[model samples]
Each structure stands twice: as structure tokens, then as C-alpha cells.
Target chain A: MRKKRMINKFTLYISLVILTFIFLFPLVWMLVSSLKNEFQIFRDMQSLQAFLPPAPADVEGGYFHNYVAAFQRVDLLRYIVNSLIYTIGIIIFGLIVNSMAGYALARFRFPLAGFWLGVIIATLIIPPESIFLPLYVLVYDLGWVNTYTGLIVPFIANAFAIFLFRQFFLDFPKELEEAAKIDGCSQIGIFFRIIVPLSKPVFATVAIVLFINHWNDFLWPLVVASDESMRTIQIGLQYFMNEPPIKWGQVMAALTVATIPMLLIFAFLQRYYVQGLTHTGSKN
Target chain B: MKGNDSSAEKLENERHFHQTAKKPQLKPTPPPRKKRKLKSQAFREAMTGYFFLAPALVLLGVFLLYPMGAAFYYSFTDFYILTPDDVSFIGLENFKYIVEDAQFRQAFWNTVYFSVIVVPVQLSVALGLALLINKKLRFRVFFRTAFFSPVVMSLVVVSILWTFMYNPNEGLINQLLQTVGIPPQPFLTSPDQAMNSIIVMSVWQGAGFQMMIFLAGLQNIPNHLYEAADIDGASSWQKFWHITLPGLRNIALFIFITISIAAFKLLVQPMIMTQGGPLGTTKSLVYHIYETGFNYRDVGYASAMAVVFTVIVLVITIIQRVLIKEERG
Candidate 1:
């Protein structure tokens, strides 16, 4: 019985390790193949001796050339800058607008407040894809195509952010604001001075969430930006991959470059990301 | 002297009446004036509240509501992007063609199958992982982070990486299978295996999120419940069934709904990896909608698909909500 139990534990560990490999395999392979030459990468499986550094001639000037090539081909630096601008723009706008709306919903008593909250919540159920067509038409009508303003403006005030901020603000202490109000400060002054400062944790959570969404986003950028100059990193990568006779090596190199900022951001802001997920669904 | 006394009493009564008439009837004079100031301040605060909400309201109206209305309108007509003047009433012809189209039917079933297969599998695995790591295991944090890191990785990156892994000749998946004495699988190349391959990659990347949700649910389940079960001499199976499962019902419902919706939106994976091929087995409703609208320039047909797809998703969500409500009720 003891031997059987030991066997079971060993099997469990092995299975888990294999599952992890399966999860991490693609990324690891991409990284490895990026360092290899075209022949080494495209060579049949049996011809390869093992996973090792490719021959010196095969690597030649190495992965750096591919990276440079990718950058030059798509003007990757501009894509990166465009992506940052669009993403940061949306997050800033979303934070201010959503926080204000959330603060109002949470603190104030007004006519039709509950009704409006319900409407906002209902919009969350309607997927954005459902309205992509008309939104495209709207963008075209405004002649906002290929503009950063168009890219960021449509998504600046998301219902999800409002919901998240409202949820966060619900548990905030009412007395602090009341005391501030009594101290000869106006409502706006109190909100700016006390409420905003106190809500840093939630504000960070919203910012991180918005930043991640905009950073990794592909579909909207694919649609809105027509000019190569206005192309975000995701759109640039997509165009590169499908431009013709797919360039896997260069694409991987480019993707690795494009993905690094998001990865670094995720690593840095993971605490907030995990916290937001954990706290969002919990009521008490 | 008696007449003088009576006149003095009448004068005292007259003085009392004058004082009472001079004072405010509703409130004491000092407090009534203060009350007016407080009321006006409250009104001002309410007005400022509306001012704060106005921008978000306007944006939501322009981006969400107006676009949704336009989508519905366009679904009824022949909406064209090139020539705005040429939109004509097509009635339900766009929607009707959806049923008659073979590709739409295939895409619909593909999406349904994806959800059907992925939802339960992902949920079960997530629950298992949550349970495994819920114990006091060494390196638990490392394992948790490693598993969850992919959740934040761009799906585009994940898709591209998996395409390399699904390469028939040198891919790690088949290579590993061969080492195990199993013949190589088609993986992504064969139509039969393409959707399944996508499912595997998706599950691997996504299960960690639900695992974390399950972990949160597990943590929230009080330890005293388990202690009580131990005292009652309940078996582990019984404890899990009566305690853990019931405790996680709401969370499980949430995961189910989210995973189901996400499964239907399986465009990025197929788009990057397969381009909906080896005969379009992995083609999903959303991908089809995208291609029809943008690639084929059939905006009317795409809108119809989008409308139908939206209705299906809404119906499924509503059904889940109703079922959950009923269960709770």
C-alpha cells in the first residue's frame, strides 16, 4: 500500500510537470527558434541533433538582425509610441471620468440614480463586438480614421470601469467627506483633496486594468487605424504576419519586442491585477 | 385701585399676544434661517453630482447606445460603407440568408461545440488545481504565478507561439507524443484536430484565471465548516460534496457564464493560428462575421450575423441568469 501511494505521488508530479511544459512550450520554442537561423528553424525535426545553439554561420549576426529588420519593416518604434499614447490616453480619461461617475453614484442621492445604475450595468452584458459595425460607421463619419483621438476617444469611458470604481467607492467612509464638507470646503474641493487621495488603491487597479486591455488589444486597432503611420503595435504585427508569405522568424522577433512592454507592465502591476480580480466578485 | 389692577392684567395679556405674533410660527427664528442655508447647500451638492456624471453619460450614449441603435438599423437595410447614399431596405433577407448559408451553420456549431467542450473541462481542472494548491504545499506561490502568468500574456502572442508548437514536422507536441510511443497527431493541420488543438491551447492559457477565482472561493469558505465535518466523521468525498461544492456554486456559475461567452468569441486564436482552416473547422461565428464584413465587404451579411450572434449570447446569458435565480430562490 505504501509503495502504491508513493507511485501515485510520483505520477502526480510527473503529470503536472508535463502539463506545465505544455503550457510553457510554445513560448519557450518561440524564444529558442528566434535565436536560430532560417535553415535551423525550418529544418526537419530529425535533422536537428538536440535543442542547442545553432551553428555560428546559421546564427550569423544572430537575432539582432531580425529584430532590426522587423523594426525597419513596420517602423516598430512608431508603433510602440502610438500604442503607448493611445493606451495611456484611454487610461487617464477613463480614470477621471469613471471615478467621478462612480463617486456620484455611490455618494449622492438623486432622481433616477438607481435607474441609471441599472442601465449602466445592463450595458456590460452587451458585448462591444455587437456594435463594431456602427461604431466603424460613426468613426468614418467623423473623419476620425487613422487618428489617435479616434482610437482612444470611443473607449475612454467604459462601463466596466464605472462598475469597478462604484463598487470600490461603496465601502468608503462617508464621514470623512462629510467632515470635509463641514470645514468650509466645497464638494468638488473635498472630492479632489480627500476622496481622490483616499482612493489610490482602486485607482491603481482601474489604471492597470485599462492599460492591460489597451496594450494587448488587436481588434479595434485593426479597424480604426488605416494608415501605416497610425498603426499600433498589435495592428503592425498582424499586418506583418499576414502581409504575404508569412515571415515566422521576423514575426516572432517583432512579437517578442512588441510583447515585452506589456509583460514588464504585467509583472510590475500584477499585484493590483490579482487584487482586482480577487476583490471584484466578492461583496463583503 | 381694583380697576387699575384689572387694566394691568389686561396689559400683561396684550403684551404676551404681541410677543407670540412677532415670532415665526414653523420654527424658532435663528434655526429656521440656518435650515434654509443647509437645504440650498444640499441642492447645490446634488446639482454638482449631475455635472460629474454628465461626461460619462454623454460618452456612453455616443459610443454604446447610439452605435447599438445604428447596428440594429443597419441590420434591417443594405448598409454599404463605400457609398452612403445607396442603403436600401432589404427587410429580413440578410438574416434569412444566414440559415441558408452552409458556412454560417458550421461556424455556429463550431462555436457551440467549443463552449460545450471547454467550459466544463476548464472549470473542472481549475477546481482541481485550486484544491491541490489549497493545501500547504511547498513552492505554491511559484506554481500559482507560473500558471497565471499566461493569463496576462497577449493572446496574440500566445496564438503565434502555439502556431509554432502546432507545426506538424518539428512541433514539440507531436515530438513528445512520438517519444511516448504514440504516432504523431495531425494537431492543427487536419480539420478534425484543429479545433481541438485550439481548445487545448485556450484551456492551458485560460484555466489559471478560473483557478484563481476558485482559490478565492475556497479561501472564503470558512475553515470551521471543514472542522465541523471532521467532528461529524464525514468522509472527504462527503465533505467536498456537502461543503466545498455548495460553497463554490455562485463562483462556479460566474465562471461558467464568463467562459461560455469567451469561448464563443474565439476569433484571435483561429485568426492567428489557423486562419480558420484545414477546411475552416476552427472558424467561429465572430471570425466569420469579421471576414464577411471586412474581407468580403458584405457588411449587410456581417451585420445580420452579428445581430444573430448577439441574440444567441444574450439568450444564453439570460438563461444562465434565470437558472441561477431559480436555484437561489
Candidate 2:
């Protein structure tokens, strides 16, 4: 019996290791292929050498050449900046607007509060794809296409963020607010000073969720940012892919660069991200 | 009697002073003014609540709600992008075209097929992974992170990477298959295999997200129930069927509905990798909508499809809510 249990444990571990490798393989392949020269990438395709960077002498501009070419081929820096501006704009405004609305719905005794909450939640069902055409037209009419206003403003007030904030604040202790009220703090004052500070986890949760969504958003940005200067990293990558005689090395390099920030953010704030996602899942 | 009168007068004066100092009413009447002040305070609080909600409400109204209404209206019109001034109502004509259009039908059924296959496959893989990592194993965090890394990467990047992998000749996938003594298959190029290739890539990219959700659900299942099952000599499969499955039912439903909705919006992969592909095998509803609206400049017809898509999503969501509510009850 003891030996059977041991074998089961061994099998579990072996299978898990294989599963991890399978999951990681594509990403690893991308990263590895990014380092290989185009010729080496093709030559090494059938062997484990595909996973290795080319030796120092085989490449002209070195292994980092693909990254350099990627930068030169497209204004990647500008696109990254554009992404940052858009993502940061969304997150900052999203945090404020969603949290305020969430706070009001959770704590305030007011007419139409329930109705407003319902309205916001109902919008969650409406896929952004369905509204893209009209939204594009709307933005175009407003002279917002290819502008920060066009990209950032439409997504600043997210229903999911507001819903998350409302759920978080609903469980917040009344005593904190009651104490603040006795000290002559207005509702807004308490929210800004007390509630916002105390609600860091939820804030992080909303921020991470919004950040990922806005950063990785392809379709809307693709439509809105028609101009080269206004293109986001995702759109830039798409444009790169569509460019003739697709340079596999440079493409992989650009993909790796595009993936790095998200990976870094996930690695750092994974706890918050998981918490936020799980909160959404379990609530449903 | 004089002392008693003095004390009584002092007490009355103190009461009057307290009322006057606290309220400071210049009006002759105090009670009605105080009552009005209380009423106005309530009104002020209500206004504050509205103020808090105004920014989000305004944006939602303009961007989300307005577009929904506008899309529905546009669906009924003959609105072309180039000739904006020549707009005219053509009720249900676009919808009629949608029903008759072969490309639209193909895209619609493709999306349905993709969702039908991908949702369950992705969820099961996710659940399987979640169960694996749910164990108190060494390096679980590392494994979890490895699995979830793809979820963080953009769909565009994932598609591009997978496109390379799906390359028939020099791609890593085909190379690996060759090593296993299997013949190389044209994954993205073949009309029959293109959608399946997209599905495989999507499932790989997506399963990690649902896995994390399942992991959370698994954690929430009380261990004592499993312990009781063990004491009852329940087999592992029996324990999973009775305890784990029941515990994860809600989360499974949530993951199912959410993933199905996401799958229905399958634009990026096809757009990036296949461009709706050889024989249009990989064209999705959203991809068609995008192509029609932007590429073909057929705004009205695309809007009609978008409206239909919205209705499908809404119906699914409603059914899910009702089913979940019923289950809970």
C-alpha cells in the first residue's frame, strides 16, 4: 500500500512537470526564436537548438539585433508611450469615477441608487464588439479619432470596476464612516481621505484589471488610432505583422517586448490580479 | 416660593439658550425652520450621491448606452461610411441580407462552432490544471505562474507567435509532430484545419485564466467534506463527483458563460493570423463585422450583425442568470 501511494505521488509529480513544460513551451519558443538569427531559426527548427540563442559569430548585429531592428522598423518607443498614456489615463480616471460611483451605491441612501446600479451592471452584458461600429462613428463625429481623448475617455468609466468597488465598499465597516462624520467630514471628504486609503487592495484590483484590459485592447485601438503616431503597441504589432516579407526574428522580438511589461506587472501584482479576478468569478 | 420661582425661571432660560445657540434662527418661528433645514440636509446628501455617480453615469450614457441605441438605429438604415449624407431608413433589409449572405452565415456558424468546441475544452483543461495545482505540491506558485503567463500576454502577440508555430514547414509544432513520426499538417493554410488551429491556440492562451478561477473555487470547497468522503471509502472519482463538482458548479457556470461570450467576440486571432482564412473557415462574427464595417465600408450591414450579436449575448446572459439563480434557490 505504501509503495502504491509512492508510485501515485511520483506519477503526479511527473505529469505536473510535463504539463508545466507544455504550457510554457510556446512562450519559451517565442523567446528563444527571438534570439536566433532568421537562418538559424529555420535551420534549428527540427532540433533542440531551436531553444538556444545563436552563437556570437553567426549573427551580424548580434542576438539583440532583432530587438534593435524591431525598434527601428517601427516607432516602438512612441507606441509604448502611447500605450502608457492611454493605460494610465484609463486607470487614474477609472479608479476615481468607479470608486465614487461604487461608494455612492454602497453607502448613500438616495433615490435611483439601486436603479443606477442596475443600469451599470446591465451594461456588463453588452459586448464592446457590438458597439464598436457606432462607437467608432461617434468618436469620429466628435473629432476624437486618433487622439488620446478618443482612446482614453470612452473606457475611463468601466462598469466592472464600479461593480468591484461597490462590492468591496458594501462590506466596509460603518463605524469608520460614522466616526469620520462625528468629526465633521463630509461624505466626499471621507471617501477621498479615509475610504480610498483604506481600500488599497480593491484599488489595486481595479487598477490591474483596467490596466490589462486597456493595455491589451486591440480592436478599439486598431479602429481609433488610424494614424501611425497614435498606434498602440498591439496595433503596432499588427501593422508589423502585415508588413511584407515578415521578419520572423524581428516579429518575435517585438512580441517579446510587447509581452514583457504585462509579464512584469503580473509577476509583481499577481496577488491583486488573482484577488480581483476571483472576486469577479465568485460574485457571479 | 420665591426661591422655587427663581430656579424654575433659570431652568427655562437655560433651555431657551440651548435651543437658540444650537440653531441660531433669526426667523420668529424656530420649529418649521429647523424642520426645513433637516429636509434640505437630506436633499443635500442625495445630491452628493448623484455628484459621486455623475462622471461614470455620463460616460456610460455617452459611450455604451448611446452606441447601443445608435447601433440599433443604424442597423435599420442604409448608412454607408463614404456617403454619410445619403442615409435612409431601410427597415430589416440589412438583416435580410445577413440571412441570405453566405459569408455572414459562414462567419456566424464558424463562431458558433468555435464557441461550442472551445468553451468546454478550455474549461476542462483549466479545471484539470486547477486541480493539479490545488494540491499542496512543491513549486506550485511557479507552475501556476507558468500556466497563467499566456493570459497576461496580448492576444495579438499570442496569435503572432502561434501563427509562426502553425507554419507548415519550419514551425516548431510541425517539427515536433515530425519527430513523433507523424506527417506535417497544414494547420492554418488548410481550410478544414484553420479554425481548429485557431481553437487550439485560443484554448492554450485562454485556459490559464479560467484555471485561476477554478483554483479559487477549489480552495473554497471545505476539506472536511472530502475527509468525510474518505471515511466513507469514497473513490477519488466519487469524491470529485459528489464534493468538488458540486462545489465548483457555480464557478463552472460563470466560467462557461464568460468564456462563451469572449469566444463569440473572436476577432483578434483570425484577424491577426488567418485574416478569416482559406475558404473563410476561420472567419468569426466579430471579424466579419469588423471587415464589413471598416474594410468593405458597409456600416449598416455590419451594424445589423452587431445588433444580432448583442441579442445573442444578452440571451445567453439572461439564461445563465436564471439558471444560476434557480440552482442557488
Candidate 3:
């Protein structure tokens, strides 16, 4: 019986290692292929060499060749900046606006608070993708189309962010607020000074969720940022890929650049990001 | 089992957390007084509350709520994007037009098919992985990160990478198949295989997210229950059925409804990789709606589809919530 269980454990470990390899293969493939020229990439495709970096002889440029070419071929820096501006803007403003509302709903005796909470939660069901057409029309009517305003403003007040903040603040220890009040700190001041500082984890979770989400935002940016100057990294990459004579190396390079931030985020903030994901989730 | 009472109680607490709102308000308001100073203080507090709420409320009202109402209204009218001024309310005409639209019908059914297949498969894979990692395994964090790396990459990036890999002529997938003694099969090029190809990629990209949630849910289950089951000589399958499955029911329900809702909005993959494909087999409802609304500028038709899409999501969510409530009762 002991020997039989030992075999089961061995098999389990072997299968898990295989599963891990399968999951990591594409991402590994992307990084490997990006280092080679187009010819070398295709030539190595049939063999296991496809997953390895090119030797010095393979490409005129070194291992970092494609990344350099990616920038020259496309204005990657411009789009990266544009995407960062939009994402950071949304996160900063969203945290303030949503957290205040959440604090109000959780602690204040605001009139119609229940009604508004219900409405906000209901809006969670109607994702932006569903009602985007009319929303676009509204943006168009406001003459904000193809502009930063169109990209950023509509998303600054997220229902999910508000919902999350409210849930977090619901369990917030009120004794801190009362003690702060005794010290003559205003409610708004207490929120900024006390609540925001103590609630870093929840803030990290929301910010990471928004950062990853808006960073990857494709469709909305696709439609809104029609002009070349306004294009986000995803939109720029799509255009770059489809615009004839597709260079596999450069495309891989662009994809790698686009993906690096998220990997960095995952590396540093895995717990908070995971918290964002499991919304109907564990507190721990 | 010995641990049954505590495990059952733990599940009850979870269900209660799901059903109830946050606990009572924290502010301890004194009884109302006719005194002028106290009345003014009450008024000031109410004003501060309103002040805090105003910005988010305005934005949500204008951006989200207004657009939703506008979409419903626009669905009934011939609200052309080109000629916004010339609008006529044509009740159910847009809906009628879409029902007769061959493309929309195909897209609708295709979405339903994708959801029905993808949701269960992705979720089960996620649950299985969660179970694996939840065990006392070495390199748990490393394995979790490896699985989740795909989810970290954007859909556009994934779609592009897969498009290259899915290429029939010289793609890596076909090339690998050839080495493995299997013939190269057309992936995105063949209409029948295109949806299946998309489904495979979709499941791979998405399973990690649900896996995290499942892991969280798994951690919530009491370890004592498993020990008790083992003490009682319960088989692994029996323990899974009696302890694990029951523990994960709520998380499973949440993952199911949420995944299904997201599945219905399948757009970017088909739009980028297949361009709705060799025979338009991969054109999802959202893709078609975008093509119509933006590409064709037929606002009325797309708005109708949007209404239907929202209704579908709303119905699923409501039904799930009510079912949970009923199950709790």
C-alpha cells in the first residue's frame, strides 16, 4: 500500500511539471522568437530551437535586435506613454471619487444611500461593452470622440471599484474614525489622513485591477482613438500586425514590450492582484 | 465525520456574508433635538455626505446609466449615427430587422455555443488546478505563476501570438503536429475548426483567473473535515463529493454566472485573429454589433443587439442570485 501511494505521488509531480510547461510555453515562445530575425524564427520553428534564443550568427542585430527594430518600425514609446497617461489618470481619479462614495455609503446617513447602492450594484451586470454604442454616441455628441477625454473620463467612476471599496470600508474599524473625530479631525480629513493610509491593501487591490484592465483595454480604445496619434499600445500593435508585410520578429518584440509591465506587476503585487480577481472572494 | 458541525457552520457564515449587506452604519447619531446648534450640525453632516458622493454619482449617472437608457430608447428608433438629427421612433423594427439578419442569428448561436462549451471546460480546468496547488505541494507559487502568466498578457497580445502559432502553412502548431506524427490541420482557415481553435485558446488564457478564485474558495474549506473523512475511511472520491464539492458550491456558482456573462461578450479574439473567419464562423455578437455600429454606422440595429445582450446578462445574474437565495432559504 505504501509503495502504491509512492507511485501516485511520483505521477502527480510528473504531470504537474508537464502542465506547468504547457502553460508557460507560449509566453516563453514569445520571448525566444523576439530575439531572432524573421528568417531564423521560421527556420527554427520545426525544431526545439524555436524556443531558444538565437546565436550571434543568426541575426545582424544582437539578441536585443527585434526590440530596437520594434521601436524604429513603430512609435512604441508614444503609444506606451499614451496608455500610461490614460491608465494612471483613471486610477488616481477613480480612487478618490469611488472611495469617497464608498465611505459615504458605509458610514454616512446620506439620504437615498440604499437606492444608490442598489443602482451601482445593478450597473455591475451591464458592463461597458454591452452599452458601448450609446455611450460612444454620447461621447460623440459631447465632441469628445478621438480625444483623451473620451478615453479617460467615462471610466473614472467604476461601479466595481465603488462596490469593492464599500465592501472593504463596511468592515473598517470605526473606533479609529471616532478617535480621530475626538482629535477634531474633519470627516474628509479623517478619510484622507486615516482611512487612506490604513487601507493600503484594498487600495492596492483596486489600483492593480484597474491598472491591468485599462492597460489591456483594446476595444474601447480601438473605437475612440481613431487618429494615429491617439492610438493605445494594443490598437497600435493590431494595426502594426495587420498592416501588410507582417514582420514576425518585430511583432513579437512589440508583444513582449506590451507584456513586460504586467509580468512586473504580477511579480511584485501578486497578492493584491489576486485579491482583485477573486471579488466574491476570500478576505485573507 | 467529527468535523461536520464546524464545516457546516463555516459554510453557513459564507452564505450569510453573500446574502447580507454590510453591517449597520458606524456614525452614532444622537437623538434629534430642536436646538439650533444640533440641527445645524446634522445639516452639515448631510451636506458633507452629499459632497463626497456627488462626483461619482454624476459620472455614473451620465456615462453608464444614461447610456443604458439611451441604448434602450435608441433601439426603438432609427437612430443613425450619420444623421442623428433625423430620428423616428420605430417600435420593434430594429429588433425585427436583427431577428431577420442572417449574420446576427449566426453570431448569436455561435456565442451561445462558445459559452456553453467554454464555461464548463475552463471552470473545471481551473478547479482541478486549484485542487492540485491547494495540496501540500512544493513550488506552489511557481506553478501558480506559470499558469497565470497567460492571463497577465493582454488578449490582443495572446490573439496575435496564437494567430502566428495557428497559421496553417508554416505555423508552429502545425509544424509541431507534423513532428508528432499527426498531419497539419487547418486551424483558423477552416470554418468548422476555427471556433474550436478559438475555444482552446480562450480556455487556456482564462482558466488561471478562475483558478485563483477556486484556490481562495479551497482555502476557506476546513482542513479538519478532510482529516475526519480520512479517519472514517472515506475514499478520495467520496471525500471530494461530500466535503470539497459542497464547500465550493457558492464559488462555483459565482464563477459560472460570471464566466458565462463574459463569454457572451467574445469579440477581440475573432476580430483580431480570424477577422470573423474564412466563412464568418467566428463572428461573435459583440463583434457583429461593433461592425454594424461603427463599421456600417447603423446605430439602431447595434443598439437593439446591445439591449438583447444586456438583458441576457441581467437575466443570468438575477436568476443566479435568486437561486442562491432560494437555496439558502
Give the top-scoring candidate (lDDT): 2
User: Can you tell me which runs of candidate 2 are displaced by over 4 Å?
Assistant: A54-60, B1-34
lDDT of 1 by residue, B1-103 (tens): 9999999999999999987887666465465778899898788867987887888989999999898888888888887677678999899999889889999
TM-score of each: 0.89, 0.93, 0.93
lDDT at residue A72 of model 1 (Cα atoms): 75
lDDT of 1 by residue, A46-126 (tens): 433324446576667855776877777778899899999999999999999999999889888777789888988888878
Q: How would you encode candidate 3's per-residue C-alpha lDDT over A19-54 as one tens digit per residue?
A: 997898899889999988888889999899988888
Q: Which stretches of candidate 3 lie above 4 Å from their native place?
A: A56-59, A282-284, B1-37
Residue B235 of model 3, lDDT score? 98
For model 2, residues A29-73, the per-residue Cα lDDT tens digits are 789888877888888888877777677778777779899988988
- What's model 2's overall lDDT? 0.91
Q: Which digits, one per residue and each the tens of the lDDT, describe model 2 over residues B1-329?
A: 99999999999999999987977665565467888898898899899999999999999999999999999999999999999999999999999998899998899999999999999999999999999889888998999988887897899899988888988987889998998999999999999899999999899999999999999999999999999999999999999999999999999999999998999989999988988989899999999999999999989999999999999999989999999999989
Task: For model 3, report DockQ.
Answer: 0.64
Candidate 1 segments whose C-alpha is farther than 4 A from its true place? A1-8, A39-65, A243-248, B1-39, B181-184
RMSD of each: 8.1, 7.9, 9.3
TM-score for candidate 3, please give it: 0.93
Q: What's the lDDT for residue A166 in model 3?
A: 89
Model 3, B1-329: lDDT tens digits are 75998999999999888656443544556755668787787788888888888899999999999999999999999988889999999999999988789999999999999999999999999999998888888888889988888998999999999999998988988888899999989999999999999999999999998899999898889999999999999999999999999998888888888789889889999999999977889999999999999999988888999998888888888898897787778
Candidate 2 residue B186 Cα shift, in angstroms, is: 0.7
